[model samples]
Target: MKRYQFNEITTMQYIFLISGTQIGIGILSLPAQLADIANTDGWIAIVIGWIISIIASTIIIKTMEKHQQDTIFDLSRRYFGRTFGTFIHIAFVAYALLASITVVFTAIHITQVWILPNTPNYLIMMLFMLPGFFITKNGVRILGRYAEVVFYLTLWMPILIAVPLQKGTILHMLPMLKEGWAPIIQAVKTTVLSFLGFELAFVFYPFLKEKKHAVKAMVIANSISALTFLLITITCFIFFSPDETPLLIWPTLSLLKTIEFPFIERFEVIFLSFYLFVMSTTGIPYIFTTVFGISQLIGKKDHTIVLLVAVCIFIFTSFLYNPSFFHVQTLGSWWEKYGLWGAYFFPIGLFIYTSIARWFQRGKKK
Candidate 1:
């Protein structure tokens, strides 16, 4: 797939793209998930994870700075040669596919439970899958545009959450660190899992319009996500007793239950319905990156065909397997382990390798 001038995304689109991806289905359960492990200290864990994400993102940008026009796939081929690079690309492609389809399945499961209990998983999958294809097929710029649009559309959501907070108690979060940092450290893994989507910087950095601003963009992206997650984490802790939190499956959704809306009966249903768009902002980038990586691997110009086929296969596969909440957690466990390697360790390792190799090349030239 050849890169086009239009494929480049502006700094704002760039910020929204990475941040938007980071804030997906995870937000619904993250506060409760963290509270289960660390009590009110879970929000602290999110801060730790956010700092870690920004550091890793900066490393990723520094790695790509050497070849500002090349993506992870291109870098692998440059430094590691064709065979190893192809293997590396294949590994990433598989990871992205797992993540993309897992996101789709998770979204379907959430929607089924909250809004459409009677709807078949396949029917719901189709509804989600179609938009994914159309959103990603146009390429990254469209993805940036989609992400930006979704970000603005959901900006008013804080107001929806504010009504419930009035009833919440600051007392619930007091006596912080009752169990000490041990529990907070245990919960870091959960927050890091929520922080998983920043790895797309591997794909996005090459297309960034202003390379000088990449670090700033990365900070803004992580800050936006960290703040959003932090706010929700604190709200849930304050709104629900720490003991009551882990009991509710989607505490953030339940947080809205306290809000008495004039026009709507179940506020969660309305919120979940609109969140379908938010879910797309999360999944579409993974889908786009998956197809793009595969196309570049095979030296194909037309990733649109690849995108269509992958989406259809995913929709088809959903009919065979319908995951419950426990099953979704099982899927999340797999992603968490894989994501640590794919999104975290891999970039740091790659950056070191490239820097050393570049140093040796400069020595030879000297």
Candidate 2:
């Protein structure tokens, strides 16, 4: 029996939530990022990254399992004490906020460039964020439902990606390991950004309905995302020449441009339009987590106040300036670095610390 049933999400919801989070704005540019380092072998880096992400996500799940009913907020306080725990919470909130902002910027940038060049950035953001506000305010159940819906809604996306393969050169992807392991290993760091969303398992783990299946859920979620990345990456690698691939910014979207149908023209526009649903999965989770963290810090049960505050902050920040494409990419690069710290290093370090602490406590009791 769960103490708070409102927040408890089902196993499938858990899977979709994490999967949706991982497949965000990064997908549009991941093929380019990987191509920059590994050339045609970039798809290999995505595989390696997926394996690493699965391991990392499993570790996070194990750590949360120790304190089955407690959120990461409570776990940090338990491990680090009050003052330091508060500091850690603030840092996570910052990470989540920045991640959300990056998604917003990416969505706006793509929308402006591909769809509406003349629309005001702030106007786009306002329309963009409205659904997030309404969805996030309801609670994790609503968020989970939204993730599930979006997952199915976009399920056909990968199939459409294959349309570009008719023109793709399969030979470009041959000669595997042509650059040896160095570049592929180096490119693994870039793929880490694509795997960023899995870390949210920490916060969501306690809400899982089937606690024992947490690892299985994570594996499924991550594999779905990994396969999607692989298919898309491979498609891009095959579709573009080695030298030509890295030059294009949004290779995934560019591939969609090659898609021709009797009824539709400029297919990339339609893809980008529906992609807002995909992007929302990323934005909503981060924004929800940020506000949830803030509410936890203040010991508030109701998250509505923090949610309102977060919305105001997000909207106010959008007013500052419209960033150029380079600026958006720069911000994304920084967020990836920050995500490395918050998502991987921090969780792994904390898990080790918790394990040691528990071992010592048991030894003392003996």
Candidate 3:
């Protein structure tokens, strides 16, 4: 017989959590980025990038499978000595801290530009963090449930996107791979980075109620993210001319402007307003993972204290440092570089080390 943890999340919740993490603020700008590098062939890059992400996610799952009941933090301690283990935990702490802050700044910048031009960033941040603290403090189950709900709540978006496509020209994307395969390959980095949320499996794997579904869950999560990006990226390619696509900073959000209804005049604004639910799914996971990792590092059963301190520190930091749009952009650039290494390169290294280490152990036992 198997015993389940008191606050375990189901396989579906696990899928939603990772997908929600991957489908954040990046999607708004990804089409424009791909357009810059690959021109009309950028959508192809998304598919390639999706394949790479699936492989990386599978590697992470395989690494964690050796320690089914332990998170990355605990695995680090077991795989490496105490000193090196603590270093990896600290690295994760820093990554999650910066990642969460970057998400806050990115969302704040978008909200101010689209809706509230007059509100202070700190005030907006306070509003965001309050609910964030409440949700994360409850535990992973709440975070998982929130993600699942947000996933369903935002399903109407594809139908809404279809409204703009009514006027889109399919000719812009007709000559696919116009410049050959080089541009698509180059643009794969951007697409892979957009799929960054899958790394959270390092923390989420242990909380999964059913261990057998880990790889399957990752495949589902990455597929949903890739398909959604394909929809958005392809929509942009068909909607805008090749020359015009690269010039836009947020082709996905800009696409929303074309939506029309009897009651709504500016559709993008309404769309972004509801998009907060989607954004929270990203932010809260980082928040929970950061606090949860810290609690485990310090040997605490409850993460509430660390969560409280982290929230207070961020709220206070917001008061002092109000990043400009350019600042946020620069921050995101740095985060992407770090994410590429953290989520991709590091996982492969860990998997190699794990395999060798276990091999040596088995040889010694025999």
How many angstroms is residue 11 displaced in model 1 relative to the true structure, after the best TM-score fit? 0.6
Return the lDDT, model 1, position 323. 84
lDDT of 2 at 79: 88
* Model 3 root mean square deviation, Cα atoms: 1.4
lDDT of 3 by residue, 22-138 (tens): 999999999999999999889888888888999999999999998788788888889998999999988987788778888988998899999899998789889999889999998
Which window of ten consecutive residues has the lowest lDDT sum in model 2? 1-10
lDDT of 1 by residue, 10-60 (tens): 999999999999999899989878888898889999999999999999999
Model 3 TM: 0.98
- The RMSD of every model to the true structure, in order and in angstroms, is 1.5, 1.2, 1.4
Backbone clashes under 3 angstroms, per model: 0, 0, 0
Query: What lDDT does model 3 reach?
Result: 0.90
Q: Could you give candidate 2's per-residue lDDT for residues 1-366 as a string of tens digits?
A: 565587789999999999999999999988988999999888888888888899899999989988888888888899899999888878888898889989989899999999999998888988987898899999888999999999999988889999888887789988999979999999999887799999888788888889999999999999999999999999999888888888998999989989989998999999888999999999899999998998988889889988988787767877898999888988898899899998889989998999999999999999
Segments of candidate 3 deviating more than 4 angstroms: 1-4
Whole-model lDDT values for every prediction: 0.88, 0.90, 0.90
- Candidate 2's displacement at residue 344, Å, is 1.5
